[model samples]
Target: MIVWSVLIALAGAFCMALGSALQERDAVRAPGHSVARVGFLVHLARRPRWVIGTAGAGAGVALHLVALSGAPLTIIQPIGVTGLLFAIVLSALFNRTRVRAGQIAAGTAVMAGLSGLLLLFPHSAEVPQLSIGTGLGLTGAILALGCAVFAAAHWVRPGPRVLLLATVGGAALGTTSALARVVAANAAADWTAVFTWLTPMCLAAAVLGGLFQQNAYRTGHFAAAYATLLVVDPVVGAGIGALLLGEGLPTTPLNQVLAVGAALLALGGTVVLALARNRNPEALRAVADRDEPTATKPGNASPGARASTTTTSGESR
Candidate 1:
């Protein structure tokens, strides 16, 4: 079961990577003011590419549910850290750029560190328990945190804004993972378990996460946004698993120290990726502009206008 879960989760990671790449391709062209708002999702929903990308993401979620049904949350959740690697490659391909060595090394570090930290936790078969009070409290806390981050993103520059949005997205999705584990476990026993409070909470969290994810993509910093998301998702999920699901980590001093080291490695990798610049920013900008309306296309603009737009875009990134 564990082996099968791993394989399924791997496939899910690829789908998620594909989804993120496709979504980011269109998201970067969205009106910047609309991001982090409901109007943003409404606009993307009209675009066929974004719709297809949403489908891919939905498929990935379904596959993740299947994987969660078979394996402990700690073991299964960390598998998603691999999606950062796939996302890096896919983003490069979409942007018509080559993947840099630094990106590869940093992505590897994030995967390794997050994977190590998660795998160090002791797995358990115990069923997850979530009382109504605890569930409500957790849900409220996540929502509050997301709102706070969203508000803060507005005052920051694009790079820091992307990271803040991704952080909230990851936290919400991590909460979703914990809730889904309980839902999956219950559904396995009684299919009617799908009609529960936790199910709605899970869906709400997923939606919140998805919104922030799109906002991050809109910032046009794929590596930083994606690396942050991938790192935070598993870290938050593992915390929820250990605290709420009874999947505790090693109690040994050596193991605890190693886990902290792994976490620091992941943090360092995320910072490196965030600082890494795109190799061909102009090319990427051109490709993204292709999705804009004909009236807004660079070809339609005067030389001075085009130059101004370019400067603005550069500063925003």
Candidate 2:
């Protein structure tokens, strides 16, 4: 069962990577004014590629849940770090670009650090539990933090904005994972668990996470955004698992030191990946040209002028 869980989790990671690549391709074409808003998702829903990408991500989540049923979060969550590597390859393929050596090295660092940190978490067989009050508090805190980060992203440049959005997205998804554990445990003991506050909160967090992810993609930095999200998700999930589900870390001093070092390594790797360039400039230019306004009204300009403007815009990125 454990071996099967590992295989399933790996497959889920690939699906997630494919979904992110497809979604990012369309997200970059969304109107700038619509980003980070409800309308942004609504707009994306109209695009076939985006819808297909969403389906892929949803399928990945389903497979993750199945894997979780057979293995502890400690094992299952670390497997998700492999998604970053898959995402890099998929993004390069979509853009018709080569994956640079620096990107490969940085991505390997991220996966290694994150996997080490997750593996260090001590798994518990204790069934997860969450009271209504605790569930409400968790939901409120996650929503508040997500909103604050979303607002902050507006003040930053495109690069920083992607980081900020991805952070919130990752946190929300982590919370979703933690809550799902509670709900799944309870439901196994009692079917009425579906009516618990945790069920709704888990769904809400998943939706919130998805929204922030799309916003991150809108910045057109797939490597930075995806890398940050993957790194943050497992860290946040492991922390929540420890705090809320009794899956604490090892108490040994050596393990503690190693855990801290692993965390720092993961963070450092995330920063390096963020600084690395992965997408092709021509792909970005194509997206810009496609999104350029077609109207001849004031500020819209003719096709030639719009082409020139799109070229400049792509260059600025």
Candidate 3:
């Protein structure tokens, strides 16, 4: 079951990466002001790449649900970060983009750190109840944050600049996933819970997080955006789950020490990816440059020919 879940999640990562590439292909050409929802559906219908990408996303989600059914959220969330590394690989393969050795190394560090946490930390066997007030409050906070991120995304320069928004989105998703766990365990019906404040927040987080992540991929360094969003979001959610909800840590001093160490490891990994990316501004420039429409594919057309092209790229991210 674990193996199948892992494979499914990894496949989902592949789908997500493909979707980003396809969406980016169009988003770069469209004016920045276009409605993202309309742009996304149109792009999906028009681009075979996007259709495949969307299918990948569906496959991934299906797999993710399977994983959730069997494993604890902490175990599953960290593993989900594998998609970030997967995104880097898929982007290289499909988009003809390059993944620097440093990017790979940093991503590996994050994976290693997250994996260490998973192995050392015991799963919560006790099902948690989702408090209605807590759920509502958390959801409200996430919605406000999402709006802030979208508004803020516009002000920031394209590139790694959008990573913050992606991180926020990721955090929102992570938080909601945690809430979903509690709700699933306690609520009479998950749909009934949806009418409460928590549902909208979770939905918004998933949607906006997806949007923010898509934009981050389109305009930011691949590894940096992927790592920051994937790693940090869940970590923040986990922190909230543990601290606020009183999810117990390992009892032994050594286990406790290791848990803290794992947190640092993840944090260090995030910093490493960020630093490596900042040092390689050229890579970021490549992403941001590709985000806007160009007349021709690299080496395929002259500058004058590109200037005359009428292709309109559009998407929310």
Candidate 4:
């Protein structure tokens, strides 16, 4: 049962990753807020592709829910990081995105380290729980901090927006995942856990993280955003679970070494993603060009096929 649950959670994470990838493609050509929303609506309305992506995400979530029911939060969260690897492969195949061998190697290191570290956490029969007051206070603080950082990042030149959104989204996803781990563990707890401040905060973080990544996809390279988010989310979640939740470590020194190694694996993967992004700046544009949009102006062959036109009264237009 525990294994099954883990599989489900992983499936959900995988779906979510794919969805993020698809949304990011759409964001590239969207230009502005209104355009982006309209683009999304149009994409979803007519394209069967988005539906497929959504279905994958839904399946992954369902699996995750079952997995959480059986395993410790600490254990499950690290394993969930596999979705990053899956996303890399899927994006490469479906989106025609470029990836470097170094990125893949680095990501492997990080995941390996994380897996080792997670093994150190003590499994408890007790499920996780959320406290309304604590959750609200913590969530409010994090959101405020993230928003401040986001604004500051936007204030700077353009390139960093990808990094900024990646950072914020990582934090948001980390918080939400950490909270979710707690909630999953506390499934057997009382009803009060359901109404706690963590509930709303988790929901909000999930939404914000989705939006942040969406925006990241629009204005920046996918590898950059995906790599940063992938690397940071599990790391942050594990760190919080260890420090705040009193999760422990492996007793043996060798295991500790393995844990560090796993962390390096995850980091390596992230580097691979980053380098890939740098090497192929136009990767995002390529994906965007392929994804069909919902609404087309009359007499258009496709969004990418439009040729520049001039009226008789040309005025530098």
lDDT of 2 at 254: 92
Candidate 2 scores a C-alpha RMSD against the true structure in Å of 4.2
lDDT per residue (tens digit) for residues 188-217 in model 2: 899888887788899999889988988877
TM-score per candidate, chains pooled: 0.82, 0.84, 0.69, 0.67
RMSD for each model, in Å, please?
5.2, 4.2, 7.2, 8.1
Off by over 4 Å in 4: 1-17, 33-52, 64-80, 97-99, 129-131, 155-160, 183-187, 249-261, 277-317
Error of 4 at 64 (Å): 4.3
Scored by Cα lDDT, where does model 4 land? 0.60
Q: In angstroms, how far off is 92's CA in candidate 4? A: 2.7
For all candidates in order, the CA lDDT equals 0.79, 0.79, 0.60, 0.60
Q: TM-score: which candidate is best?
A: 2
Residue 297 miss distance in model 3 (angstroms)? 28
| Model 3 lDDT per residue over 58-138, tens place | 777777777777766666666766776776676566546567787777778877777667666555657666666877777
Error of 3 at 90 (Å): 1.7
What ordering of candidates by TM-score runs from best to worst? Answer: 2, 1, 3, 4
Name the TM-score of candidate 3.
0.69
Off by over 4 Å in 3: 1-30, 33-48, 64-80, 155-160, 187-197, 250-252, 272-317
